[model samples]
Target: MSSSVGPGDGSANRDAEFTETLKSVAGMANLTQSRQVIREIGSSVIQCAHDRTVSIIVARQVLDGLAGKLRSSGSDDTAEADAVVDIADYLLREINAQGQSSNLVDQTVGLCEVAATAFETKEEYTEAAQRLASIPLDESRRRVSPEDKVRVWIRIVRDYLEVDDSTAAEPYLNKAKGAIFDVNDAELNLHFKLSQARINDAKREFLAASASYHDISFSPKLAEEERLHTLTMAVRCAVLAPAGPSRARALGRLYKDERSVMLANDFSILEKMFLNRLLQPKEIKEFAETLQPHQLATTADGSTVLERAVIEHNLLGVSLVYNNIPIASLANLLGLSNDEAKTEAVAARMIEQGRLVGRIDQLKGMVWFEGGEASGQNGSGKTAAPVDKELRYWGANVQSLAEEVERVTAELQKQFPGFVEANLVV
Candidate 1:
């Protein structure tokens, strides 16, 4: 008649058994045995445990078991990819469960990382980033410091950039920057700047992006590969830049750098061809044939950078030798077919972009270069008045300054809305 176990003791024994089962699952080496044990415990039992740490350990064990099976199989089966998706779903559920556990931030973040990596393996970059970004926005979180919160936000911005969706990336980038505003982490700063550069690039602001890349390329904190990649991007941006003093300076900086030689070998034949075109405009055609489709200027729609560079060089060459040239002849100099409308269209773009300091005469079918100032024909012909030229230049400067001020104001508002509004109120 000795012992009927008390209700409290019976509950305590079950809790201990559940905790021991978790430890056993974590330590299990035999994949088959681990799977069997998890099946025995069942989802209902595990969910009822309501212990975030136990959920994390079980999820990690399952992921490891799946990976071990794949490694041993030696052949990738479609079934394996499906298995990965299932595991990612499980991890996602675990993360949701842990949202209100203040002590489980690292485990929750780690589970999200695993899920993201799995999605990335399937080339679902946007989904991968979204999974991480969702953590910060979770309403159930017991506590998350802004600094800790930004860690996942940074990952979201990066993954969006991987898919070239800067429009979608913008909101997350803004969120990440706000969270890290008062934190002084060098790595986060670099990541933020890199995202900004990429966003500028996606927006087709090549000059500003080039400046950003150039600055990052010189950061002493960058790893070797990162520095090289940043420098390579800087060169690409410079080459794609519309013709101007800024483009000239960007090219000059690249040519003067010794690292440009390494870029020719490590990056692409495209780089070498581009460099040759810039330094010796005559070589544009010879190297132009080597450019692949991706080397094209993206904004120009299937037009290769080398082709545009050739047209630009021909324009510069003619400006030195002739006060004015027929549009057809200029097209011929650049090896363009004799299409009057097409040639004039190309010339018009260059002129409009200020790459060619000239005006296109459609009625005359000729382009005049700065009234022969470019050809030094002013010594042999007429010239615009120096006073008029100076005034026009200053007017352009005033317009440019106004545009830059407006851009800065918009950026400040985005980056520091509260401060901006407070200042405005004051």
Candidate 2:
């Protein structure tokens, strides 16, 4: 009653049925259905390969078919996109185990790009960048040109920065630099320069960053908005730079630029006011009020720029007039509160940095400028009456000691003439 179909016949029938099912799945208009088909194919491939020792050629066909379905599914659907990545992972393993293919490297790279795009869409920027970097650039069969290699390297730099890892970006940037040689592309060069500037800024080398921004701003090929933005950044860097003539020069250049007028802020005005020799403490205070919290240096008391400026100004003002003043009076002149703690904090900074040469006496409530006449006198600020008894006794003791030293030297010379000539202690 039973008719036997041979083992080979049953296997052939199953394979033909699978091929037909794959074709039908490929033709389905619904993306969700298409993903289900790919998943089914994956399951069948694994099952058949284990039970019947499916040939590598058949496995390759199934993989290629799955990739085709994935391409048709598009990237917008999360389920379909993840399925594509899963299939790519399987294909990669198969290709690695079964030996290389002429087209496999390209296919692998394509899959990695897809995976990276998916990760990027999810805001997993670090993983996305890593996926792109895993491409086999050194493969002899890789068809990517020198320029494309540089592009890849540049992307790595950007990715590293997205995660705020400049230390990691640096090696990749160097690789990009090496790859860019002999590549005569202006746009790529600009991007490289911009990335370099950003890296410098992230590293807190504002002066170097300003120089880079200045260079990029002058490029005729850049857009007007971008050029102006770069110039504004350069101005900020110049302002933030340690006070020096170069900072003055940078600010001067920014002030003279017509483009700077377009920036709607007090940055330029602040820079100008800070540089003027005749600028008063009141003007500095007025300008300081306009800056945002981030623009000023912070202390335990408050965010203050004018505090430091007024302190320096008062020190200079007093240096020009009265070099000797009580600490309380100095505090009052600098517009500081009567609190000696606040006064000492401000004055100590200037004196410690050698910007002011002075000494403070907290107990006596006095400050003595190095060159002031009061410095040579006692704290009463009056010269002592001439030669007290105690002072004369000290002077006599010093004179007697000097006379005894001279007599001892003469006696030594008389006793040992050659010894004195050869080994005289000066």
Best by lDDT: 2
Error of 2 at 65 (Å): 8.6
Against the hidden reference, what TM-scores do the models get? 0.65, 0.56
**Candidate 1 C-alpha lDDT tens digits along 1-426:** 212233454444554566556556556544333444444443433343353323444444443443334234322343444444454456446435644234344444554565566566677789888777755445465466676667667778889888878888989878877777776788878888899888877766767887889889988898889898898787666656555455666677776777767776323433443343423444444444433344454445345664565455455556666777887887776666776656666655555454556665555667777742222222222234222233346768989999998899899999999989989653
What is candidate 2's lDDT per residue for 115-183, written digit by digit as tens?
Answer: 666565556678777878888888886667778887777877787777777888888888887878856
Number of clashing pairs per prediction, in order: 0, 0
Q: What lDDT would candidate 2 get against the real structure?
A: 0.63
- Position 225, candidate 2: lDDT: 88
Off by over 4 Å in 2: 1-33, 39-90, 93-103, 219-222, 273-426
Report the Cα lDDT for residue 322, model 2: 64
lDDT of 2 at 54: 49
